[model samples]
Target: MEPLVQDGEAVAIEQEAPGDVAARDMLLDRAMGPRWRKKTSQKIRQGRRPADGLAFVARSADGGLAATVRLWNIEAGIDPFGRPVPALLLGPLAIDPALKGCGVGAALMRHAIAEAARLGHGAVLLVGDAPYYERFGFTCAKTGAIALPGPVERERFLAVELVEGWLDGAAGMVVPTGRYVTKSRVRATAIAA
Candidate 1:
């Protein structure tokens, strides 16, 4: 059922249409099912926020949505060589569960990467499986030199270079873009309350 396109043809993967949040929510609900809630319940998810970088979804030639992916702007900090790691953060990349095994996810991922690269990003950072992400040239950042406030699979905190070897001299911790500061403020208020 994993099809890259209808009959091996390329599907037009593009940035989500204007005001597609509802559709994105619905898609996540359907694709993730109950697993979404449990994962959302984790406190770590609160502390460790991925920055919004870019998003792409697979659509039929008729414009019917098939799958989705999103990116966030995040910082990987400075590397051993005092260089900053500029990265596009990706997450909640869901393909309709029904579309699992189909090439929808792959198409969206490829398109997303291409878009970010076109936008001049240094790398992509995501929390995902080693075996799964390996297909896209990603590797675990266990020794990566970035820190996370919450728990994540050591091997799953990964980064992929948009420019070959972009990470060679960069090292540091990942932090949510501006959103993290907002969340921190909210948390602080809650604590004071």
Candidate 2:
């Protein structure tokens, strides 16, 4: 991904690396506060690996983490016939408090969304501010019939289809379908349950 320049600072967007784990977690905590782990999205992500090649981060010119976003594999819902609807769940897109509104978050979002499309994902679901995500083509148009495992503000549920009509008839409860992380890895990562 390309570096984004904002207010004379250059922030490079890149794939999340092993070394970025601690920094990313700290950044997320700082940006979202301690309660972020209890969100409904976390329930779906617990014990699962982010979809392959979908986790990303932004680093400032000083090499400090600036922002992060990740997409998880999920079943949006089962169709009437009962087959799981495969989709991507995006969440916890956090930017360092200092970097908020500096375009780092936007850059990372664009990169992640484009990469997901490149990887042939059909759609992306998220619970977020409709105003912010709408700029990325996300809306609740197709998410009305979809349900998460826990409570979420109705207006906050959103989706954007990469392949036109991929979510046309999607309905039922959204469920985690990503590869499970090993117990040891989960313990090391301390993934929120």
Candidate 3:
């Protein structure tokens, strides 16, 4: 995909690659710090990849990683009527400290949301600053009744319905519904090694 030009800079949005893993993690560390590992979002992402075709990074004109965003498959638990509501969890949208307010994060959000709509996804839930995400159409109006498995500032839990009414009456705990990577788990034998 061609990079989007904002403020005379080319910010390319592309699928995150296997080769980008180390750099991605490092950028995340720099952006989020060690405390990132202790968040409720970390628990949901601990052993899974982003939802298929939903992981993306913003690269600077020189090809350095500038920002990252990931979406994960999750259940908004069961709705009020007891039907399961499939949804995507968007989070940890980390932008390089140096690139904050450079429009990289906004570009990533637009691209991801557009892609998700194209892929027929319904709703997206996230824990984020309402003022920041509200620009992308996320609102607490849809998330008022939803909860996370761990402690979170209730006001920060927000949702956006890619499909109208997707979040209507959908309320419950959000849980990881994607493939959990077992390869990263250290077995007892490996622990002794």
Instruction: Tell me, by TM-score, which candidate is best.
Output: 2
Q: Which stretches of candidate 1 lie above 4 Å from their native place?
A: 1-4, 7-11, 34-53, 81-83, 141-143, 178-193
lDDT of each: 0.66, 0.91, 0.85
Model 1 compared with the native: what TM-score?
0.74
- Better TM-score candidate (2, 3): 2
Clashes of each: 16, 0, 0
Model 2, C-alpha of 120: deviation from truth (Å): 0.3
Candidate 1 lDDT over 1-193, as tens digits, reads 1335655544577667545656765787788774663552222334443334476677665566678877777667776667666666676788766567866787678778877888898798777778888898788753357666556767887778888877776665665553453665556534543
Q: Encode model 2's per-residue lDDT on 1-193: one tens digit a residue.
A: 5678988998998889977887888898999997888999999998788999999998899999999999999999876777888999998899999888888888899999999999999999999999999999999999989999999999999999999988888899999999998888767677532
lDDT string, candidate 3, 109-133, tens digits: 9999999999999999898899999
Error of 2 at 188 (Å): 1.9
TM-score of each: 0.74, 0.95, 0.91
TM-score of 2: 0.95
> Which is superior by TM-score, 1 or 3?
3
Error of 3 at 92 (Å): 1.0
Q: After superposition, how far is residue 19 of candidate 1 from its true place, in Å?
A: 2.3
